[model samples]
Target chain A: EPEVTQTPSHQVTQMGQEVILRCVPISNHLYFYWYRQILGQKVEFLVSFYNNEISEKSEIFDDQFSVERPDGSNFTLKIRSTKLEDSAMYFCASSIMMGDPYFGPGTRLTVT
Target chain B: SQQGEEDPQALSIQEGENATMNCSYKTSINNLQWYRQNSGRGLVHLILIRSNEREKHSGRLRVTLDTSKKSSSLLITASRAADTASYFCATDNGSGYSTLTFGKGTMLLVSP
Candidate 1:
């Protein structure tokens, strides 16, 4: 069972600093997505990527957020400037046929 | 705007008992997916039912979708303590992409 993998299981950063969360989706998957869970809140969609461009994004994915598939295997989400509200558990997911999506363990981002 | 909303925010059951969680969505969707998330972890894909399909099953998990009513239910049979987690329903609103909007999850605690 190949699964999505994310780096830096947990991260702590300053409020004004930049943070880049990295994910390596399943090798053969064509669609990739990023979602966030704010502590006890529901998981929220951030962005979706396919064919090397963003397919969709949520309001939470504002000016500070950007996603890129810098290479064949890596999908990165960069926050230009972090805020306290940006602290959450970020998950990366991928699907092969737009059916069941497989998720990674997630990266917990903590901004202080 | 939240696309999905799950009912009965929390549930507790015995190991041998069955657990049922219901999900309701606000709009038409191409597919509905159920996911399980252990505390402090990312979501694990459970099952997916297309709008055209009424029911689906995998192992002890059964998922039913009623597109006309815009609702879905997830049933876990013969539960175990390991089944204690949060279950969420996500919907892809026929956007022709993989961006999923998720609802607040139902927390299940199965005591052994």
Candidate 2:
């Protein structure tokens, strides 16, 4: 089965540095999403994208965060400046119908 | 309050036994989905139960949704040690292409 793929499985960055997490969703999928899970906590929604624009976003998705579909296959999430609290497992997901999302293996972001 | 709060945060069962996990949501949802995650891994989609559907089954996993009560349950019958993982319930409040709210998840350990 086709699955979402993310690059840089693990990233370590300084608190003031920027980090960009990349994902390639299933080729035919139309809806894409980003979510994060802090250690031992619930997975929190960050943002959703469809029709080349953000459909929805959570309060946690502040100015520091931005998502781009720079190409037909790549969906990237960039953090302007990392924060210690921003360290978490970030998962990228996509779906043809949006109701059933297939997730990628996730990128573990560690900011010191 | 949490949107999708699952009960009995942890469970342990012997091989061949059955395990049940319950999830309750605070608001109306378009659909509810179940996902499984092994330690330090990404989520694996298990099943989805729509708001209009009461029950759904896939393989050994059975999911039931009660929109009136705003509750859902996941049953894993004839469990195996490999079934050990964290199970989470996520709810999409919109009918399509929307953000999902997830719960803390239930950690289940099946010993052989």
> How do all models score by TM-score?
0.97, 0.98
Query: Per-residue alpha-carbon lDDT of model 1 for A3-108, expressed as tens digits?
Result: 9999899999999999999999999999999999999999998988889999888889999999999989999999999999999999988888665778999999
Point to the candidate with the largest TM-score.
Answer: 2
How do the residues B10-92 of candidate 2 rate in per-residue lDDT, one tens digit apiece? 99999999999999999999999999999989999999998999999999999999999999999999999999999999999
Task: In candidate 2, list every pair of residues with a backbone clash.
Answer: none
Give lDDT for model 2. 0.95
- In order, the first chain's TM-score in every candidate is 0.98, 0.99
The segments of candidate 1 whose C-alpha lies over 4 angstroms from its true place after superposition are none
Position A81, candidate 1: lDDT: 97
Q: Which DockQ values do the candidates obtain, in the order shown?
A: 0.80, 0.84
Which candidate has the top score in lDDT? Answer: 2
